[model samples]
Target: MIRKANLQLLIDREYGIGKHGAKAEFARRLGKQADYISRCLYPAEKKGGKNVGEDFAREIEREFSLPVYAMDQQRLGSDTAKTIDVEGLPAPLAQKIAGYRQVVEVPRYDVAGSMGPGTEPPEMNMVVENMSLDANWVRNNLTYTKIDNLKLISGRGDSMAPTIRSGDAVLVDSGINTVEDDAIYFFLMRGKLQIKRIQRGLDGLTIISDNGQYPPIEVPGEREEDITVLAQIIYWWTGRSF
Candidate 1:
């Protein structure tokens, strides 16, 4: 059977906004409606999500010129992108290792975010030194569709304590603007950029600080106008003395 996660990752890597992948173009190429394609990709029960039938799956393979039954395989996206040795690793893990040769520069920017690797101008010199990351690894290991949708923002204070210390830089996924689930997020609050772990509960939402010294703040429902979820922190990096 064709795995839904496999197909979704394929779409993300091959047809997401990053890496020159556009859903509208993909839809046009398949001779299908963009909305229909989105429903197939996103597949939410509350929304108009649907599964791709066997016939449609075969059609997709044919359209993409993939081998017969390729979609039925795990990590279908990983196998097709510039073949390389996986060293017998699992499909999910193998894909990440296969792209060590493919690296991209991820520049540092404000939490508000005005730049990324793909859009860096040579004269600007905004790109951070030694900030290059494996392209395919970023696409596979990180968020599926966030190949170029990242920017480095410096974390401040010890609100997140042992998890994210003061002055450490976090790789923020600029593509996510909503709180789809509970996770650490870099956001704007009352006109200032802030990072915190956000959780949704039955009564309301709680903005938490990993450091217990700082108390959590509760926001009833969502304050879209005052608070903006600028991006989600996918990865972080720091170097220090012993």
Candidate 2:
């Protein structure tokens, strides 16, 4: 998720300045729009590299009559992995998903039953050749160390590539709250899973992809199926080639 823009919004929210206030008004007077400030908060897509660096800060300070602080470690990156604790979530639901890291397993086996007597035993011709059981499920499949409802699942498509690649493992936390914006979430529709940023719309929600190749997906309109949020992706683990 875009933390910088969100932070600026939070600042606006706290100060009752809304999006169009002195800060924004002064920035606009200096020819810097809200998007400029928003981009300053997080410089993912801006030109001239990320965050505009020192030069942008100087410009903002000189023209906008604002203070531009150096980019600290805390200022960078998404807030997803930083903190995740939701209020008002149902206790039962939270408990149900808590520590459910064990992978459910179903076992397969073949069974043979035969009756032998003095008389010629009836041919045990394939009486029952198959049986299935979930064996060693808790012991072998899943992890139980972390007491979090978050679990990792492999991503499938290139829609969220670079940010979240195919075959990459993404951590999903159902305990997190769904915010309206660019947020990685495990959204379920008709029992299928989709990882996309949540965009607020006039009617409902919009699912956005980072790659830009795939168009944004709108829920309820494009697909009439029910949209259930399985979890929100907090962090993803990817590998670097040596």
Candidate 3:
């Protein structure tokens, strides 16, 4: 039998039960009842109820981007002792599963760029630090192919309130320097780095703030190069607030 501790570790590491209502969020993603998932994580000792079964284990492997064999070992125990080859699976799926086993380090800049009203953007000195993120999370969340080009920077200002709050850390894909319609981007405007939603117009590009308090800014289509696009904001997380 698979030890309960191993299963609990997987839940705590991946689902993060107490953090951000992760248990409920994971349940919703897995399309399973929350109570049932809770039971699977903490099975009853007296009644000897069924633990997480192979069906649910496979579902978790597929949905959560985990190795099926690892979960199988923890759920089915000796039955899954023999090494299973992943070569039989489709090439793309196999490659993704293989990538999940690795970790990637992303560079985090020292400066915090404004998202709302602010002065000129500060210069990016050397990278202040590096953060190790799961390769699976990076590949699944970001559309960019070159993972090395990804950078992390902090956003300052309430102009983008409600959606992206002040002091939030955003992941910027430096490879995507082009402005896509209605897409949020981190760019340099008048030497100041700012993040805003861009909308292409007949005459120019419209820069918008999520907060209604701030009015939009317009740039002539011919002078688009003046506004140097640094990167497109892919993902962001609350900094100190969390």
Instruction: Quote the positional error of residue 148 for candidate 1 in Å.
Output: 1.7
Model 3 error, position 117 (Å): 2.6
Per-structure clash totals for the candidates? 0, 1, 1
Q: What is the lDDT of residue 170 in candidate 2?
A: 56
| lDDT for each residue of candidate 1 in 96-177, tens digit (9 for 90 to 100) | 6664545466778643221111111134325444455545657566762355777776776666877787767788888998
Give model 2's TM-score versus the native structure. Answer: 0.37
Clash pairs (backbone) in predicted model 2: 107-133
lDDT of 3 by residue, 24-127 (tens): 76677888776666666654664534487767667776775666656656432422445446798999888866654344678998867687665476554579
Question: What is the C-alpha local distance difference test score of each model?
Answer: 0.67, 0.48, 0.72
| Runs with alpha carbons beyond 4 Å of true place in candidate 2 | 1-147, 177-181, 220-225
Q: For every model shown, what is its TM-score relative to the native structure?
A: 0.50, 0.37, 0.62
lDDT ranking, high to low: 3, 1, 2
True-structure lDDT of candidate 2: 0.48
Q: Candidate 1: lDDT over CA atoms? A: 0.67
